[model samples]
Target: MSLTKITDKAGLHRHLEAAMQLEHATIPPYLNALYSIKPGTNTEAFHILRAVAVEEMLHLTLAGNILNAVGGTPDMTVPGFVPLYPAYLPDGETDFQVDCQAFSRAAIETFLKIERPAQGATPGVDTIHKGRKRAHHNGHKRHGTALRARHVPGNEEEHFYSIGEFYQAIEEGLERLHAEMGDALFSGDPARQIGPEYYYSAGGGLMAVTDLASAKAAIRLISEQGEGVTDNIFDYEGEIAHYYRFEQLLLGRYYQKGDARGRPTGREVAVDWDAVFPIKANARIADFPEGSALRQGAEEFNRAYGDFLSLLTRAFQGEPALFVEAVGGMFQLKELYYQIMRQPLGDGTHAAPTYEIPHG
Candidate 1:
């Protein structure tokens, strides 16, 4: 049982940067399923997806805060920042391909996989380890170029079994670095931290990370809100974990207090699986012909999404105040999404936002 190690500052930077990217990776797919829901339908599913997406944004901000706490710069503008469609999450699973598809049972299943809880490992001690043997379920093709991000940069194949484990490794590394470097490890600029005032999300609230304690808290909150809350169906904040929230849509019932695992005894949750737009799975801009309305809509979406990322870059770098404008920018994307959604692709499926951040 050899474990991956983050032995230096540069390695920590890579891991945190990957953490930010991992958090951001879940957003587009979730949004794809979220916005894909038809008007006046799938109300329960919509709120679940929307809340989880917003929490992912909070998680991203917390990751950036931890990165900045360790004197590392947060850059969302880099190439490979926005992964290709059907991108693999950093959860170390090779079986599931997170796709940009419309709302359906398949999408909910993928969401469940993305937020699946870990079993058998304690948080700080035995969480991070080598990757698992590859599985052949789900019929998802492996993308050779986009390997699972490992703690050791050169060894991209090794990865944590769960995203919580990934962050746990980062937390452990922070403890080690803090012991070695003491105050020097927390030398990052304080001005770069995004405090609670700038972020308000359902799962959790944001906190500024200034030292090892705050840094560890930021990392732990992300895991708990995502998968670390597996010990209980609901987290300390009394909100259901993202995994169970999505599970409600599948089980056709909401989880109630005192409900056992895998069984929710609450009121029924109605899922209109047939009410989605049937957006093309894993859509790319190249799929649409040039000069077509769908093509222009997809291209315009990419440009607007690029500008949103730029706003996020500035907010993460030092201008935390810009997050308000960035939130506004996020809502603005919904219009572009609707524009593409309204344009039929003629294949009985409508266009979806490809999230292909334009490269400059």
Candidate 2:
């Protein structure tokens, strides 16, 4: 795909808007899938997914930073953030599906679509591949050679590449988004740049940091913010809220008017905690009499997840600075949860697979 550059405000606006929203969109499912995994065993996949997920958080902040730099107000919590599986994308070039079906297969498909979207896939348009190299085999495409080949996964049905592929695609899309709209892309109200009220760090500040250098510094700060320093949406303001994206999958219920900041006795009142994941209680592997491998995996995940939560609570109870470490630890919970959820439903007889998001 041909790369589009942000030449005017409008172009900047559109690309960043789409980029920011999409970045936020990624965090929800990633959080759910990552958190649902049983902790610590599916080690390799865990690390990979965690890295991508965190970086995607970084991507969200980076997109927000860009919006700020361009005088755009970045809204973190917004509607349309939570999405369904095999989700549809606008301006999507390929037939590939983007979903919350959190698994290696889903992960791979997600990475592929985000990295190498079907935008600008015109004939004879050979773009150079510039990224870390892995062993290459398949199709007429040469190894180490970059071309806009159709990015179909090993599983033929999911036609996306990988996260890195999507990253590259975003770079290309930056240009396309710009060319298509020009100044209109970046032309949002500069007044929207986050101020003290909108910007919050667990213990400190995320006030508007204008200019590139300050922007990078602020990005580093918020990307590291989690739990103690500032509770994540998972444990917002000292509350255990939501059982899956504000209730889409959790009894189809929702929580509104969550308690305000510093009210930290229970889950943020804003999150709907009453909603339930039907399988969450009974689904624990330890709950089953048979004590199958799946049960063991589920139990192990629960233990680690509990520890992870404890760390966050303590981090907040003591020094918010503890949040940084909590970030990494909480990440482990996500990895573990994924492993736990991977147990196929009755030998793949399950209908409509789901990412084990414990939010509502």
Candidate 3:
């Protein structure tokens, strides 16, 4: 597939929304595995998954800041924004599948694919075009004269093979638009930006973007942390990226500095697969019987997830302080997920968070 060249502010904003959605997409599956681990067991794997999930949240905030820096509104509460489980990453890109499940070989493998590095030539193009007409999917029509790009199969000029490529295209767009629009490109209100004070407990602190340089740094942080720098598995912060961490679990060894690619020579790490609660893969609220404890627990978990999104939406809307409340919401989600895990489904399986938005 070909890359979609972004030329104007509108296209850049659309891609930023896509970026936000892509980052948000990784959290549910990660949380699914993280919460599924039995308490006091698989401690190392639990920490690893939790750390990665937190970084994904940071990536989401950075994408929102990038959108706001470019004078675009960040909306996370929109319908269909919170994807159904086993959904494709980045919404329109269907090259991979992500499933919500307990911590198992299959779940870790899915996480590995989600953070895999870009392999070939920056997956997309850098050419800019004006008035290019592209076909829309699902019988939907493009409402304006702005250039529309889709990532359907066989469309070489409108698809990206990996998340890194998608961000690279956004970076290129930012550069071009900054050259054209200069200071006006970062004209969004500074009050709307969420800074480090509001976000904590992550590997990297929040980056508030006000110009092209800061914006580029935020994008670099997200990309390198996930895909790594060039071919290396370590990010600039000297931490192993998500893919290598998951690989370490699979190889039964940790990745130490100066280790060769695909061969981790560090100390051994233990993963107790039996320690995970047997939560059904991609469990939904409807899967449980009505008025049952499992169903009620699943419903409550979904409600908390929805409230978290609501707070996040408000944070992106204008109230940056709402991020703190949203962080608290995240804590509530952890408790709720564990509560569900403690309740057995009576078939040798345990309850798990459905991750569906309540009333959505």
Candidate 4:
């Protein structure tokens, strides 16, 4: 539980990589649930999940921009970047389980937990508390914090327990580095920045980062849209944060401008749980029988998912225009996933996309 004290550029780069992974981790599970809903039914839930998933992509792009601004390459094609099913989220941190499954109450609860704010935790203002002291891998003894090497795998001891804390650490590190290096800290190519033209429907527009202020603004947008500011339910863009959106489904009600927290007094919302296709929880590619049509379709969906990731990696690498292609890939995935959901498995259930990366 010792906080990883990021002190240099290499440390920041590694943490940003973790950030990118963290953002990408939420998409598959969210997509699994979103695609499971019956078309024309649960429209509210569908829109909510779809919006959040798209914003998660925005968060990923923002993290990549930060890395690029610091002269670090954002490599999404790395091995283990696309985690296996029932994956632990916010990689290198807590053991919050996320799974690929159809839409259900359990799925919504999982989404709520993923987007929930860090309870009683203040970002950028509190000293990260360490649960225990441990020796650094380099045989150096540090007090009150842990020092870990950048980009080294299996270094779970160096991560923050919550996404907010992780970004807070990055913010602190950026401030320190900017003070030390000034304009040199943002030494990456300006042409590599991805702007609003490359991304749309991500709630707030994507901002390209060329300096410390822009970088901080991008990070803040990510945090606020996911967890909200302090205890408020709305982000700066007047949109409800992901946590509150899930809460609405749980409460079966929506929130208005004057509604109190925990008591959404807006319009009533209905969720038709029975309308969802009964996609098995944590469904895998192996679950479908071999040589079956379901298996073939699921495998094809996984391959497309892998292709989408490759395109996203290229977009982050240098070609921002590739984002349009990646977005189109997402639509193609939706079609495949829905087609799979429509197929029957000879049981009381239907086929569901396994969400595995075939080429990962």
Candidate 5:
């Protein structure tokens, strides 16, 4: 469907504009660092960051669809739209910083600021809270999270606290959606939300949602990122096309689809295990000589990562508001992590640290 044209018409034009704009905001820094790297050395970090960056485009498109279905002009060009990242969103604790010089760990910090929930824990007054219906399902999902982070360094086992509570909290929002939309809730034209023509990213995560429930669920699937699927804050429907390019570089094969869904799957998922990552994960720690900037970076990183995880424990219940604190704490630690990761560790490789949810 031409974005300029539409079939069904019932949505907020401004809302869609805002969503897509939000999505587009992330493109630059990711672009600068990904393309600036030396070809084969930083593969892991490159692939991961590039994959994530492309997916952000897809998110922007999806946001556009929601807007277009309701009669909105998808505006990519906005004043200061590409404003440098690490630039604060409406309510970030610290100004998000996205300097092009050092991306390794710093990129993720800017990202966390963008991705981590905003502060203002007070709902309705400071934050808005919708009432609920299907609290149970969300509660069930909130049961636990595989990824737990801390501001204070910790082990994987320690970060496994149940995400069930967060899911439960989100249920209130879902129930609110149903209450507001009623039957139109799950019904939309597949051509309207999901489309195969613009497949982007690794898994071709976009499913061309055609109904309200599918719309929410389709977008929701994106809430989680896996090998094949990922969601970018941009909300573009097809920006992901840029993601698998590095994969294309590594696997020496491009992603294509055999399914009616027009998504990349199965053998299409091939990769060259031998090919080195395009960017540095900085997984090594011995190349640099002792007492260098690199050595200092390593120590700083361990402590910062530790802090990011500790904050995750307080809001494991899905309190988006609490995520505000986690988000803020994450940034502080993120800046520290970035500085440390960028310094060339004596050896140029650092140990990869894993997280375990704390028992709180």
Candidate 6:
């Protein structure tokens, strides 16, 4: 099999748009698990989920900046921008499906798979390995990597072995296109850039991409934060990369400074496995009775989520400060998540945010 490559300016835009979707894709699952945890229990898991979700938002913003830097429009309102639950990621992993579910061992396991690094594959390195096939999970046949840009027109299919390699391809494309097109490559309006002042999250601050160097920095931060390059556990800043942070939950310990890779020798990480509200996996609003309050709550959450994305769309378009309003909307959705999760599904499970962006 030949390695996937980005060969032109339009092709690079498609990949960056896919990167935005890829970053935003992880948020719902993380939020579902984070909100489903009973208020006080699983504090460690709670912190990890919350932090990772916030970082994903940052990643999405950074991708938007890079897209805008390269004269490409970033549109979150595009059809199929929000993925259905239990869907495969744009990162080309066929081993597991990400679902909107509660915080549990199973959810964390999926999170690990989402953030899993491709060993021996660094950014700018070819990731195609010959003759290696993964057994399909849940009896689903491997149909190769799914193209996230099916909703977008005039773009060819692209796939990567991991998120890091995906961003690396974008970075390399930026380099190639910059050399070929010169200043014309970064022809985007500077007004669309979202600086650090407009965003603040626990994971880290945002970077504004203006040139190839800044664009590469933004992509590097997104990839390294998701999965540290090579075999390293910590990112460049000495902070634990997201993969290791999630792994800490599975290993039942925190990673401390000077700890060797794969062996977190810090204090025990406490987890109350039973403290979570067992919401239905891959839940849809249809799961609730049409006239039921649970159904209304799920729909309301989806509507609010849609509105939040709209706010984000405007923020990315020109009004970067709209992020403040979007942050407020997130808190509102948090309350709605709690209201829904508190209601019983009558099957020993509870309701979760369906994340279905209601269309006109």
TM for every model, in the order presented, reads 0.90, 0.39, 0.88, 0.88, 0.41, 0.90
How would the candidate models be sorted by lDDT, starting from the highest? 1, 6, 3, 4, 2, 5
lDDT of 1 by residue, 46-98 (tens): 88888999899899989999999899989888877887888777545555568
Q: Which tens-of-lDDT digit does each residue in 109-178 have in candidate 6? A: 8887788776463344345432222323237643312334333334333445577767777888888988
Per-residue lDDT of candidate 2, residues 132-207 (tens digit): 2221322222211111223323312211222223333434444465567554444434443434443233234544
Clashing pairs in 1: none
Question: Between 1 and 2, whose lDDT is larger?
Answer: 1
Q: For residues 1-360, what per-residue lDDT tens digits would candidate 5 score against the true structure?
A: 001111123212333343454455455456445543445655655676667665665665565555433334443333333333333321111223333333444444445434432223112322322222222223322211111111222211111011111222222333455577664543433334434443533444555444456446544543433112222312244333333333333343444533212233434433333232123432334434468665455555544544543433233212224435644664474454444433433354332211111222
Candidates 4 and 5, the one with greater TM-score: 4
TM-score of candidate 3 against the unseen true structure:
0.88
Q: Once all C-alphas are superposed, what RMSD does model 2 give against the true structure?
A: 18.1
Task: Please list the C-alpha lDDT of all candidates, in the order they appear.
Answer: 0.79, 0.40, 0.78, 0.77, 0.38, 0.79
- Which 10-residue window of candidate 1 scores lowest in summed lDDT? 143-152
Which ranges in model 4 have alpha carbons more than 4 Å from their true place? 1-3, 91-95, 121-129, 132-156
> How many clashing residue pairs appear in each of the predictions shown?
0, 57, 2, 0, 87, 0
Model 6 TM-score, all chains together: 0.90
Which stretches of candidate 5 lie above 4 Å from their native place? 1-15, 84-86, 90-97, 117-178, 181-194, 200-203, 226-360
Q: What is the lDDT of residue 285 in candidate 5?
A: 41
Q: Please give, for residues 29-127, the per-residue lDDT of candidate 3 as tens digits.
A: 898899899889999999999889989999999999999988998987776577777776652344456888999999988887788666542234232
Q: What does the lDDT come to for candidate 3?
A: 0.78
lDDT of 5 at 339: 48
- Candidate 2 Cα errors over 4 Å, as ranges: 1-11, 29-36, 89-94, 117-209, 212-360
User: RMSD of each candidate?
Assistant: 4.0, 18.1, 5.2, 5.5, 17.2, 4.0
Residue range 64-126, candidate 4, lDDT tens digits: 999999999988766567667676554334434677778888888888767767646433433
